[model samples]
Target: MSDSEKQCCAPKRSRAGRPPDPAKDQAIMKAARDLFLERGFSGTTIEEIAANASVSKVTVYKRFCDKETLFEKCVRKEIGRMAEAFDVGDGSSEGLEQRLNAFGLKLTKFLTRPNHVALDRVMGQEFAQVPSLGKRMFEAGPGQSRARLAAVLQEACDDGILTCDDPLRAAEDLLVLWRGFIEVELKFAVRPAIDEESVRERVEHGTRTFLRAYQR
Candidate 1:
C-alpha cells in the first residue's frame, strides 16, 4: 500500500511491436497507383485495389478512409519522398551551380519516373470527376514541393547567391524550363529516358541557364 510498493505493482509498460511492414504498405500503394493509372479513379474500386494488394478490404479501409483518400496519400507520399531527396543547400559554402544542378537532377528524375508520370495522367483524368481531388493533389504534392523550393531560393537570395526578387515566381520559372522537355518525352516520346549521364547533362544545363538568368 506504500508509494514504492504501489509503484512496483503498477502494470509494466508493453513493449512496442515490430515496426509496421513498410514493404506491405508500399505494395498496397503501388497496386493502388497502378490500378488508378490503368483504370482512372472512377473505374478503380476498393475491391480491385485490395485484390491487387493481396490485402483484405478491412485492412485497406483501416489505413485509408476511401479510394480517393488512399490515392491522394499514395501520390502525395511518392512526391514527398522525391522532394525530400533534393539536396537544397542552406546557401552556405556549396556553390550555387552545384546546388542548382542537384535540385534540377532530383526534380527531373522524379518527374520522369514512370510511376510519377502515371500518377499525373490519373490525376488529369480524374480531376473533372472529382474537382477537389485536383486541389488536394496540388496541395499535397507539387504545391508542398514548390513552397519548399521557394524557401530555399529565398535563402539563397538573402545570402547574395542569387538575385531572385520573388522566390515563388523564380521557382515556377525554374520548373517551366523543363516542362517542354518533359511534355515532349511523354507525348512525342522523342526524349531519351532518364539515366545517370542524361540526368547529369540536363542538370548541368539547367543550372547554367538558371544562373545566367538569376545571378546577381
Candidate 2:
C-alpha cells in the first residue's frame, strides 16, 4: 500500500463520546447574561456567574477565557436569536397592512423585553470603555436586524405594496419608530413595564405611519 492510500484509509475520529451538553452551555450563557445585565461589565464576576449557573469556577474558565469574552459571546448569541424572530413569513400574497402589522408586533415585543432593555443599558455603559464591544454589538445586533428588515421591505416594494427607493434607509426609519421609545424608557427607567396594551398600540401606530410613508 502506498503512503497516500494508507492515509486515505485512516479511521475517522469518533464523536460518540458524550457530546458537550447544549443545555449546560445555555444555562451558563443565561447566567452570565443575567449577571451582566444586573451589574455592568466591570461589576460582574466570573465566580458570581459560576455560582449562579451551579457550575465550578474551573468549568467557567474552561468555557470562556474572561468576562469580556463571555459577555461578547452572550451578546452575539442573543442578537442572533433576536434576528431569527423577525424572519418574514410566507405572506407574499397578503395585504401590506397585515404584513406590516405582523412584523411590527414581533419587533415591538422583542424591543420591550426587560432583558433586552437591560442589555441595551449595559452596552451603552460599556461601549465607550470597550470599543470592540460596540463593533460586535452593531454587527450582530442592530446591523444584522437592519439587513433582515431591508430585505423584507425590498420584497414588499417589488410586490407594489410600498414605494421604497432605498429599502435599507426605509427599514432604518421603521426601526427608529420602535427603538426610540424603547431606548428612552430603558435609558431613564421612566417606564417600569410596557404593558401588552402599550405594545399593541406602539405596533399599530408604527405600522400605520410606516405604511403611510411607503405605501404604493
lDDT of each: 0.70, 0.71
Writing each residue's lDDT as its tens digit, candidate 1 over 17-134 gives 4555667667789889888767667778878888998987665665565676887887677666665645555555356566666666777776776655655665676687777988
Error of 2 at 147 (Å): 1.8
* Candidate 2 C-alpha lDDT tens digits along 175-210: 887555665775578887787787778777876788
Each candidate's TM vs. the true structure?
Answer: 0.74, 0.75
Clash count for each candidate, listed in order shown? 0, 0
- Note the residue pairs that clash in candidate 2: none
**What's the lDDT of the predicted structure labeled candidate 1?**
0.70
